[model samples]
Structure formats: structure tokens, C-alpha cells
Target: MQSDADGRLTPGGGTDALFWGSLFRDLDREGSFLQLQIRQIIVSAIENGRLPLGARMPSSRDLAAVLKVSRNTIVIAYEQLIDQNFLIARERTGYFVAGLPKHIGAAAREPGGATRDDGRWTSRFAHRPSTYRNIVKPLDWQAHPYPFIFGQFDPGLFPTNDWRESARAALSVPEINNWARDLIDGDDPALIEQLQLQVLPRRGIRARSDEIMITIGAQHALYLIAKLFITPTTRIGVEEPGYPDARNIFGLLTPNVVPLRVDSGGLVLGDEFENCSLVHVTASHQCPTAVVMPLARRHALLQAAQSHGIILIEDDYDGELMPEEGELPPLMSLDRGSSVLYVGSLSKALAPGLRLGYVVAPAPVIRELRALRRLMLRHPPLNNQRVAALFIGLGHYRSHLARVGSVLLERARILDRLLPQHLPHCTWSRGAGSTHYWVSCRPGTDTVKLAELARAQGVVIEPGDVFSIDEGSARHCFRLGFSSIRTERIEAGVERLGKVITQTG
Candidate 1:
């Protein structure tokens, strides 16, 4: 049946009957099973775009009546289709075409489904984004014997039961009523409340609902901030050996991207920072370097930002995965005038695929973000927000963090003992309360070569070149993570990796 303008299919007697008839006509009557043939036909129709997106299908009873088949057969076929991505079943709206990819369920209707509308369309664009060259990991990273990749969670340690429980709680009728619909503010109020109550307190931050905004993740939060604050005329400062992703975001917005030098103490805040309109600093557990900015320096940075009227963007990378001791409070807690905007993520702590993070800023900034968010995605899936909130309210968030802390500390100790013994000539950074170790190699020992050699030996590690912009991807340094690697494999992984480092050195 053809759909109305709203994509609602109406049971137009002749057309609807004939449409199903044509679809079923091609079905193999001599096939081993009748239901399987019908399922294949429907799958083919969806993939070929014969049944367009959101074009509703007839009711099971109606389709069955038209096709001269038992309702049970049609029902089973539809359920299987829904299980796959070929179709989607709305709660009350009935079955609909899910807009599955052209490659699935059927052979191509024709080569390259849609031809070009306008020739050579590359001539126009609002702003061309910067090319982000991330540290490339193999697609089969999981199958590898050793993986020392950073900012990942060990799947074994994931709070599966706890997360499932929280999800169940969120899915209940009362909680479903809370987050099932869209919000004007583009964030779950319960989530904001939980963040204010549970997550931020550990960082020593106290923020009102007006001052907080839940984003798709920290990456999205950075994009919103850059979109609002950065312009061609604005001078923005980022750590020299900073996050390449953040640098890429700012690069897309403005050409005046200043790479600020970072010493062992963290972003070298001085007269250099005073000239910029906004500065992005990862003070707590500096990216790649893993250096925690000293409390004295944190105060000085706030003083500088306050004095110069420079807004600071602090990406609290891995700030939540701190070990048993030696961790500093977030800079946001110390910002009396609210000059700092803090970005925190669940990706590091919980799971990267979850794509949940939040931004803590002044009330005015959050208000602007709400409008921007409404325009772009209308608030990350409320279901995820609700699940995260329930996770926090149930005390799983803290307990999960504690579990991760213990796991990481033991891994860190494993690396500490093995790295020095294996690669005796190399020196490394001893940054505390982080998941990875930022190792500095000998003067000419390019860690990139070492990383490649290590990979060949069935070990995976990150080369520290992408971390630096000024010195062309710092060749002498590399980041080694234990977050995803198993404790048992830690020794062998480092042993093989250290042999590569020593041989290359």
C-alpha cells in the first residue's frame, strides 16, 4: 500500500492487496518452507527501496488476509525482520520500513542507487573541517594477543549486571514517563540532577542545573563551545601536545588556533595565555603526558583566565579513573568566577561506545548550548540519559569507578615493575592517578618505529606523535595504556613491546 504524506500507510483496498500480491508473486512456492520464502521476499523489498522508509506495512491480520496465509506465519516472519534491522516496529504505530542499507537483503536494484543531482558539488561548503589523523589501531584489535591502547575499558570489568539493572529501572513505566519524550533543555533533568549530586562532587564541583548541559559526549560539547565562542578573529589557545581531536574542532572553526607550550607542570600559563580569548587545557591528567597540573598552577591558571578575561576549557580526561591516592580536585571547583568550562566523559570510566558526557559551564553558556542542541539532535537519546541517571542514583557509578581504580592501579604496578626491567635505557613519565603511562624514550629513539615493531610482535601500543602539533608529533614519546589489556597479558605485552623498544633504540 502507498503511504500518506506523513509516511502512514493506509489500507487502500486494491493497491494494498495488489502490492502484497506482487511481493508474494516472486516468492518461491516450491521452497522448502513457506514462511521463509515470505520473509525473504519482504527483506528483499525493504533493501531494494521498494518499501520506502517509514512506509508502514499492513496489519499482520490484514497482510495475512490479503496473502491467503495464516496470521501466525506472517507474524513470525515480521518478528524475525524486526530482530534484524530490515524493519522497525513502533509501539502502537505498527510495522514500518527501517531504511536498511542498500547492500543488505537483496541484490542491488541498479549500480550506485542514486546518481549525482548536481555536478561537481564540492565547490560549496560552509566551512571545511580539519583532517583529524588519529592514532590508527587495527580493526582486529580485540583479537590481538596484547593491546595497550589508551582510554578503553576492560570488557570483563564492565558492570554488566549493574548496568542492566539500571537500564531495567529506567525502562519502568514511571521512569519511562520521565525521559521518553523530548525536553526543551535537550538534557534529562534526572541526569543533570544525578551529575550535580554524584559525579561532580567527587571532582569537588558544585553546579546548578542551569550551569550544566548533557551532550552526546565531550566531543559534541567541545563542538558546541567552539561554535559559540570561536571565530576567525578570536584567538584561542590549546595545549601544544594537546588532544588532536580538540585541535581539529577548533581548526574547523578558526584559523587562529594557537598551540600553547606544556611543561611538566601542564599548560605553560603566562603572558602567552593572556592574549587568547579562550584556552583549552586538560589540567587534570593532561592528555598524552598524563601530568596532573599542580594545585598552585591551577590557582595561577584561574588567576590568569580571570585577569585576562580568557575562558578556559578543561577537558577532564580520565580524571575519574584516579588510583587509591594522589589526585587533585578539578579546576572547576577552584574557579570562583566561573571562568572555566569543564568537560567530563563516561567513555573513559564506563564504556567508550556509550557516548555519554557532560559540560559544566556558566548558566549563560548552557542556555546558548540548549538552543544549539535543539538544532542538532534535540538532546542525545533520552533513554541513555535516563539509564545513566539511574546508574548513578543506584550507586553503581561510584562503585564502578572504585572497581576500575583498583584494576588500573594493579595494571600500573605491573607496567612499573616490567618496563624498567625490560627497557632499562628508556625513561618514562610517572604521572599518578591515570590509566596510561606517558613514556619518554631516548633522544633519537622514535617511538613510532617502536610501536610498529611492537605491533608486528602481536602487541599493540600508541605512538605519541599525534599528541604534538608544534614539534611534528613528538617522536621520542609514546602512551601505553592498561585500561583494556588483561592483567595476565600485561607482563607478556610489555615484555614483547620492551624488546621492540630496546631493539629500535
Candidate 2:
């Protein structure tokens, strides 16, 4: 078929080719299979009455020739549509549009109209979570030349083959039987077993299966912990430049959330611990700052918590990816009095979209959390749990971590070399084995503005002010993440960013 003057398809001197080629003009040929695309087009046309009920469809061969797809593609699409009751096939004749269900046909035929109502949604809402400040990253970060964004994956480093192998293994008959059922208030035993055997020992954590509960993510674990423990009057101490989500979660329940100071070590042990009943700390690597808590500091924080009779929530995010020299035992591993509740996730090393995390606490605490979780979500998807379990059990998890760690280490080293030459006016944190650097630009430098200008030049960096409760403290600071950027592009991207900073300053 060939297009006429009005951009509609016309048959090339043959009436056999259908003029319906206008429908497939905008087809997304690159996205999915041609067969599925054909089915979608036909279904949409029928539902919208463009192809009315009992309307004859183009023959598979003629339609395939017009669309430049294989004849088998159209045939399979037609057969599938016929099976689904969207189309009817005759032995010798072409397919016809099948009658749709009453609701579907009526809705498709009806014109959409806006609902009439007063604008009382704001008054009805009990809380306005949207007013809170959040750490926002560009949705198109991948399209940029330099995406120095934190907690995002490098597509190149993902273990595609290994993950696929595990996913395929999880789909087997026996594996499906194991994970297909609902487990109210319970996790996949295989995942729990894998966590106990292959995961927790690295952090010196040893816990019974009863003491562990799988969560949708670390945020979910924190939410459950907060719901179970936090009251409006409870005093919760959080690190000054700590995780924003944790701060926000606690703030939702209590007005007595206190900001604890952080130095070169981690959360400073002081009078702040004395007043707060609960404290949240990122022991392994502090968020935004990427500061690793020292052994002495970790010991001091634990002692202070004990002396003050305070419970501690330790979020050990990205700790598993720490270099051998930089690795420190988690607070949960050292707690003899059961004062620490440890939260860990595969998000930092694995993909964030997976949203798999676990909470390790006392048995009673875990039991309560499980009950609370059941009320909310029943349980994290069992299939994902099974796949993760298989991924770990097959030894792919450790190997993937090793490979990713090597790449990140190399990228970090590149940033280490490039930053001094390009941006000498800025000082940065020297947290070993960190995927990002917390940088303090020259005095009076507005990093938020700098970031905006830098983005115009294809460089992306995160401002540090959002991490701090007191915005003035981090006004001149920013964070540079090396995880998602390519190694060769690092030097040029940094050089460009330095020029922007200089010109803007």
C-alpha cells in the first residue's frame, strides 16, 4: 500500500489491501511484538466503533502486506482476539468484530464529561503530605550526559543474564506451587532462609527466623516500626542531616521529633539521646553525607542509648556493598540488650524498583510488625521473594555485588582524581566505599541555582539542603553520585560542571 496526498494509506492498484492503514500509522514498532500491536489496534478500533459490530476485518495476508509485517503475525493476532471474544473468525472468510459486553460498549460509546462538585477536597483531607519537601530527581536522568544522582542504578551494571536465570527458575512447576499461595502475616520461608544463610552474616547479624520479617522496602519497615512504637508524645531523635523519609515518617506520628547533631563520625552521642525515647540512625553510611560511623562512635552511641534507656532503629542501607576495609559491624550485631532494630535493603546494590527489604528485631517486635503489615498489604509479593531467594541461593547475588562494587569503586576513584583538578574551591567528604560524595562548594555558592544551570549543560547534581532540617546548614553544599555515570564521561562531565560553577559564582 502507498499513502495518498492526505497521508492516508491507499492500495497500490489493488483493492484487496484495506484502507485501514491509517490506524497503524502511529504503531509503536520498536516497543513490543508486532502481533500484540496488531491485536491492540484492532481491539481499540472495535471498542471505539471505528470498526462497527459485524464489520469485516482485512484478510491476514493483505493486512500484513500493507503493514509490512509477516502474514503469520496478523493470523496469530486474529486468532488470539477470536479466543478473547473481541473478534470472530470464519473458516473461509475474514474476521468480524464481535459484540462487546454491555458495559464496555456503553462506556466506549459515551462521551467523557467532568464531574460537577464543590472544591472541598482540601477541607476533607486529614493531612497534607504534599506540603512536605522531598528529595526529587529528574525522571529523565538517564537521558543526561552526566547523571550524578544518588540511589539510581547503572543500567550497564545490572546482571541481566543472572536475574533472568533466577526469574525463569522461579516459574517452574514446583517453584510456582511454593509461592502461588497467600501467606497471611508470613514471608516466604525460602527468602527468610536465604537471608539467614547468605545475607546477614556479613554484618555479623545472627537472628532466628521468627525475628525477621520481609517488607516491601526499608521505607515500609520504617513505617511499620513507627506505627507500632511512635505516639504523638513520643520523643524521636533523628540525625540532623539524616534520611528525609525517616524524618517525615516519624513526624507524621509525633511532634517531638528532635534533630541530633552529626560530625565526621555519625550521630553525636549527647544530651539529645537523653530526652528522646526512640532514635533513628544510619550506622553504616549516613544518607546524603555518606559518613561511616566509626567503631568507637558506634560503641559510644550504643552505650548512650543503653544509658538513656532508648530504642535505636538502625538503617544499614548500602552497607553490604562496603569495601572490606570500610566494613564495620552493625549495631544489631553488637546489641546484647536488644536495643537496636536493624533495617536493611537490596535497593542500594540491587535495583530500587525491586523494593525488597527486611527488618531484624526481637521476635515479639517482628510478630507485631507482621500483624500490622498483614492489615496493610498481607505480605510482599511471594513471587518476587522466591526470585530473590533463588538469586541469592544460586550465588548470583554475591557475584553481582562483587562486580558492581568493583565498577563503583573505579568510578569513585575517577571522581576523586577529577574533583581536585576541576573544582578546587569545593571541599567534600572522604567517606570510604561510598557511591556519592557530599561536597561543600565555596562560601555563598547557591548549589540549587548551580544545579539548575549545570543541568542545562547536561550535568545533574543533587543539592544537599533537602537532607538537613536546617536548610542554612547545607545551602552551599551538594552531592555528586558516581554510581550511574559512565567512567569515561566522568572527567568531561565534571569539567563542564566546574566551568558552570565558576561562571555562576
Candidate 3:
């Protein structure tokens, strides 16, 4: 049985092409082969009785066209399925589902096996991490005409071919042997070497391999450090409007979380440092506000850290994405007393999903972090670490950064020019190399309302309320990120948001 040209099933009966298409809609493309994915889809369909025994399958060419995959890929998938007895090819016609054991072919028609309604589990939990106010962005942000959301990458800027080349190299037999085994609190040596030789130098920092540890991301590094250092009596200072995750991570351990002030020069140099045992600062580029800390302030902070015996956790998450003009050294690089723990991520300029980040510190600190990390998840996937090492070693990492930095610089300049014209009612701050604008509307204006209105107009924005520890302090502020939106769309998006703002006012 086969479908007619109109794609409708004929009286002879065949698996509908529409059904086949829908079956593979949610295929995981991250780490799987298309041929294997297709084969698995067919196998699942057969096992679920969607493709009953003797049910005809679509021709290779037709299915390939529908799936938008190469003809060779479809043929390979069909041939492999046939070899596995999940399918049987009928010469000159098409393939059909093969007869299988009763257990294999039978479908459990009862959707989602019965379950008892257990009593509430919230009371059993020690902490409720979910109740924390978090930055919310639509999962379908890409579908919007203008998505000014932070920390997301524009697909066009991703280095597809270069990354694929690196990934392929990592899959080689020797490379596989290097990363396949359970590392158990260890990271890929090659990646560590690459970070030491290639990455750290850009920030004017140097470290021995023993002083560095790989993390799933900068967030994971923060968690490990917090678990090891923070106690109920420990006084930790963070920026007033700063990275919420850092504050939350610290708050979980201690109630002495202090909200420090941030001005144009970055974290204000005040007596607040005297009360802190540790301070978490995003010195390279401030989290919600992309204001770079000046060199003078960097020195002051270091001095304060040394004087007060405070340990500074520097999150250089976007350090690599800074502009060349006024780039300042990371605190880790400038510290002579070893008071700074530096955390960096390749995910900011690269892809966030990669979750490759590292912490640079004194050897003793690294040892403790490694042990804590081992208890949590041992280490980040070795395969990804190896691939990132290959990417850096091959010089693709810097080149990719150069290209993305240039594009983002242009986008930032455009925002700078357009904001004054389109949003006169609001003020914004974007330092030299910042990728986002911290925008403030007129007094008494609620940006949460503005964001809701802007989103209805197909423009996505991030309300600044979540970044504030004081809750209501940032009610009139918002953040606009240009990394995810296309350059040409910037003007239109801003203009549309301007109209929404006027309407709201």
C-alpha cells in the first residue's frame, strides 16, 4: 500500500507521510546522527503499533523529501532498519513493517500508567529554590520579530563549520580514548593546557594547570565555591543590581548576603568591603548593567580585599567579548596577594548550551573545588572539553570572537544612536564593550508593564526587576540585549518598542 500524489492514504493502505513527518518532529539533533534518529523513529512507531505488521512504508525518495534529509541518509536508514528486522523491503514496491514477537509488537494502549495522587512533597524539601524571583524570557523568543533578550546567541553568528570540524576531530579514536573514561574530579588535560596557553593570556592572567578547574559553566563554579566557602555567619557582598543566581546561591547557605552599590565606575568603593568575608563581582562586565570596572577601581578593590582579608570571586563571563579600546585587566591578573578567584566561560561568545567554563585560583583552592565538584557531578563532559580544546588550539575561538565582537559592537552603536531618538522618555547605559543596554524609564513608570506591552507588539525585553535584590528598586528599569537579534532588525524593533512605550505612558 502507498499514498497517492496528494499525500492522502489510498484504499490499498499505507503509513501516511504526514504521520511519518509528525513522528520525527521532536528529533534531538544535538548529539545524534540523522540516520540513527530516523531508524529509531521507525522502530518506536512499529513498537507502538502506529506502523502495524505488513503496513507499507513510504518510498525512500518521498520520505527524504518530506524530512528534508539527503536521499542517501534515508536509504541508509531504511537499509539499517531492514537488517535489524524492524522493516522488510519489498522489491520494486516499498518497505513494510516486519513481523515481530507478540511482546515487541503489542502496544500498551493505556496512556501514562496509573499513579496515585501522593500528598504534597513541598514540606519535605529543605529549601525552595523555585520561589526565587528569576529573569524570565519566552522560550519561543526566536519566533519574535525583535528579541532583545540577554545571554542568547544569534544563530547566524555561530561558527557551525569550524565547530563541526572540531567535533569531528574529537570523535577520532585517539580523542575518544582520551575523554571516554569517567574522569572522576578531573578535566581534559588538553583543554586545561589550551586555557593556560591561549585563553588566560588575553585577560593578562597566568596559572599553572593545577590552579585551574573545569566546570559545567560559570554557574556551577559559583555553586561549588559557595558550598565550600559560605556559612551562616559569613558576610558576602554582591552588587545591588547584580547576577541573581550568585545572590541566590550564596543566600541558600547564609543570611548575611549584603547588597553593595554599583555606580558608573562599577562596584562602589565603600566601607561596605569591611563587613564582607567574600565579595562576588562581575568585574569584567557588570551583569545587568554592562559597565566595565575602571583600572583605578580595580586597584582599589584589590587593596580593599587585601586589607579586609576578603576573597573576591570575579565572574568574567563576558570578558572575551569586550572591546579593545578600554579593556582592563581582570582582578585575578592584578592581584599580588592571591585574593581573587577568577571564573570565565566560553559560552558567552560561543554557544551557551556548551556549558564550558573554568575557575582560576590558587592551587589549594582548586584542590578543594575539584573535590566539591567531584561530589556534585565529577566533572563536565570530557568530550565537550576536548572539542573546546580543539577549537581553541585550531585558532577558531579567537577568530570567532573577533567576528562576533565586531557585529555586537555595531549593534551596540546602533542602539546608542536610536535610543535617544526613539525612547526619549528613557535613559540607557552601555559601556564601551557591553552587549546589552540597561535602560531606565521615567520615574514611576513600571517597566514590567512596558515589557508586557512590548511583547504583545512582537518585541521581547527583559525587565530589570529580577536583577535587583531590593525587589522594588528596579521597577522602572529594563534591559535590552542585542546579541540575539539581527542587525537590520534593531532599528525597527526599537521603533516598535518606542511606540509601545508612548502608548503605555
What is the C-alpha lDDT profile of model 2 across 175-252, one tens digit per residue?
999999999899999999999998998779999999999999899999999999999999999998978889999999
In the range 390-434, model 3's lDDT, one tens digit per residue, is 999999998998898899888988888999999998888877677
The runs of at least 3 residues in candidate 2 whose Cα sits more than 4 Å from the true structure, single-residue gaps closed, are 1-58, 91-93, 97-100, 105-118, 322-324
- Ranked by TM-score, the better of candidates 1 and 3 is 3
Rank list by TM-score: 2, 3, 1
**How would you encode candidate 1's per-residue C-alpha lDDT over 177-235 as one tens digit per residue?**
98888686568888889989998988899999999998877899999999989888888
Best by lDDT: 3
Q: Give the TM-score comparing model 3 with the true structure, all chains together.
A: 0.88
Clashes by residue pair, model 3? none
How much lDDT does candidate 1 score? Answer: 0.83
Among all windows of 10 consecutive residues in model 1, the one with the lowest summed lDDT is: 104-113
